[model samples]
Every structure is written in structure tokens, then in C-alpha cells.
Target: MANHKSALKRNRQAAVRNARNSHIRSTMRTFVKQVRTAVATGDQAAANEALGRAVPYIDKAATKGIIHKATASRKISRLAKLVNGMA
Candidate 1:
């Protein structure tokens, strides 16, 4: 419980931000999972397509501070490698 008015406002803001951040993070994970699933299924075309969709989601997540820039780069690199290896 926040005693001060500003603290109460901040708590409310934090709750909203947490929900928004969670959505972004969940979307990012779904994109990444799609790419991985495509790769695992040995569908190069599908994997490439999913990877394409995932890159931007990943970059956006990084840009929005949901994930670290390096982590995003690493994920992109790994996904690319998987897709490339399928060819």
C-alpha cells in the first residue's frame, strides 16, 4: 500500500507498464517459437518466412527495452543460421 499520492500513481503506472511489457515479450516469444518450429520441421521456406517476421519483432522488443540488444542480435543470428543451414 502506498501512503503518498505520487507513490499510488506510480504503482498504477507500473501495473499498466508491466501488462504492456508482458504482451510485447509474449509476442516476441511466439515469433521466435514459430521460427524455431519451422526450422525443426525442416521446412526451409517456412522457416525463412518465420525468421523474417521474427527479426522485426525481436528488434522492436529490443528497442522497447523488453530485451537486450545483444540478446536480440544473438537470437536473430541463431535463427538465420538455422534457416541458412536448411538450404
Candidate 2:
């Protein structure tokens, strides 16, 4: 428990940020899963479409500091490879 006013405010801010970050992370995972699901179906067009939609969300999450930039690049790279390989 935080006794000081500043500490209490910090706790509140942290809680809010935690919730927001969790939501963003969950949404990012959903998008990534969509891309993977599309890829697994072996439909090139659908996979490509999903990848296209997913990349921006992944990048945005990285830029927002929810995920690391290299992690975002790796995810995009892997998904792109999967989509391209379907060709």
C-alpha cells in the first residue's frame, strides 16, 4: 500500500498502463494468430491479406513500446516468408 500521495498516484498510473499494455499485447497476438491461421490453411491470397493487415499492428505495437522492434521485425519477417513461400 502506498501512503504518500505521489506513491498512490504512481500506483494508479501503473495500473492503468498495465491494463492498456495488456490489451495491446492481446490484440497483437490475435492479429499474429490470424496470420498464422491463414498461412496454415495454405491459401496464398488469404495469408497475404492477413499478413498485410497484421504487419501494421505489429509495427505499431513495437513503436508504442509494447513489444521490441527486433521482435516486431522478426514476426513480420517470418510471416512474410510464410506468405511468400505459399506462392
Candidate 3:
């Protein structure tokens, strides 16, 4: 439904970006899930390690505009708290 040529090109670019963003977002969610699973299992060391891995991915996602920076910080904080709370 893109009439102009430039519009068509933009549509194509948007589609590509959408797919890439979706992949990155899915990966971020998976990383978060891993950290949560580790916490749920009460493995403090594993949870810490998973949180370490997850934070970078979250930051990258935020930088890439897939997620908000504050959201990323909040997620990292919550995960760290969960890990810390696991005696």
C-alpha cells in the first residue's frame, strides 16, 4: 500500500528493522527468563551469573531502542535484588 518509491523503500526498511528488533527482544526475554529460573531454583551463584549475562543484553537492547534505558535499569535492579535475597 506504499504509493511512492521512497515510501516503498521505507516500508522495506521498517520490515527488516521490525524483524531484527523482534529477535533481539525475544533474546532479551529469554535472558530474563534464564535469570528468573535460576533465582526460582534458589541457586544464588547461578542466578548471579545469569543476571550478569542478562544485564548487558538488556543494556544493549535499551541502547538499540528495543527497550527503555530506565526499564533496563529497573530489570537489572530487580534481578540483582532477587539474587541477593537468595540466601
Candidate 4:
């Protein structure tokens, strides 16, 4: 119950942004899971490919402010290390 018109508009905008951010976060999690699954399967090639796809998704998520920059970097680094260890 926003009394002011601007407050109402801001509330609407926040709802929209929340939905969009949720989708982005969900997609990022899916990508990360795919990479981890590939690694767990012990398929180096598949793991590498999945990691490749995941890196940009993670970077984009970070750039969009969905995730912290250091968190994204750590994720990418861990994925890379997993891929490297498989090789």
C-alpha cells in the first residue's frame, strides 16, 4: 500500500527487477551444476566444454551484479582447477 504514485511505481519496478534477477541467478546455477556434473562424470572434454560455457555466464552474472566479483572469480577458478585436474 504505497500512498505516493512514485512509491507505487518503484514497487512495481522492484518486482520486475526481482523476477529478472531470479532468472539470471537460476541460469547461472544451472550452468555451474552442469560443469560440476561433467567433472564428476570424469569426462575431461565435457567438463572443459561445460566450464567454457559457464565462465561467461558467471562473468555476465557478476557484471549484472547478481553475484559478487570475488565470488564469481572463485567459482571460475575452482571450475578451471577441476578441469585441469582431470587432464
| RMSD list, candidates in order | 0.7, 0.8, 0.8, 0.8
Model 2 segments more than 4 A misplaced: none
The segments of candidate 4 whose C-alpha lies over 4 angstroms from its true place after superposition are none
Query: Between which residue pairs do clashes occur in model 3?
Result: none
In model 2, what is the error at residue 79, expressed in angstroms? 0.7
Residue-level lDDT of model 4, residues 1-87, one tens digit each, is 898999999999999999999999999999999999999999988898899999999999999999999999999999899889987
Cα error, residue 20 of model 4, in Å, equals: 0.9
Q: Which candidate is the best by lDDT?
A: 1
- Identify the candidate with maximal TM-score: 1
Model 3, stretches more than 4 Å misplaced?
none
Candidate 2: what lDDT?
Answer: 0.92
Instruction: Evaluate all candidate structures by whole-model CA lDDT and list the values in order.
Output: 0.94, 0.92, 0.93, 0.94
- Candidate 1 per-residue lDDT, tens place, 1-87, comes to 999999999999999999999999999999999999998899888998899999999999999999999999999999898889888
Give the Å error, residue 55, model 2: 0.3
**Candidate 2: how many backbone clashes?**
0
Ranking by lDDT: 1, 4, 3, 2
TM-score of each: 0.96, 0.95, 0.95, 0.95
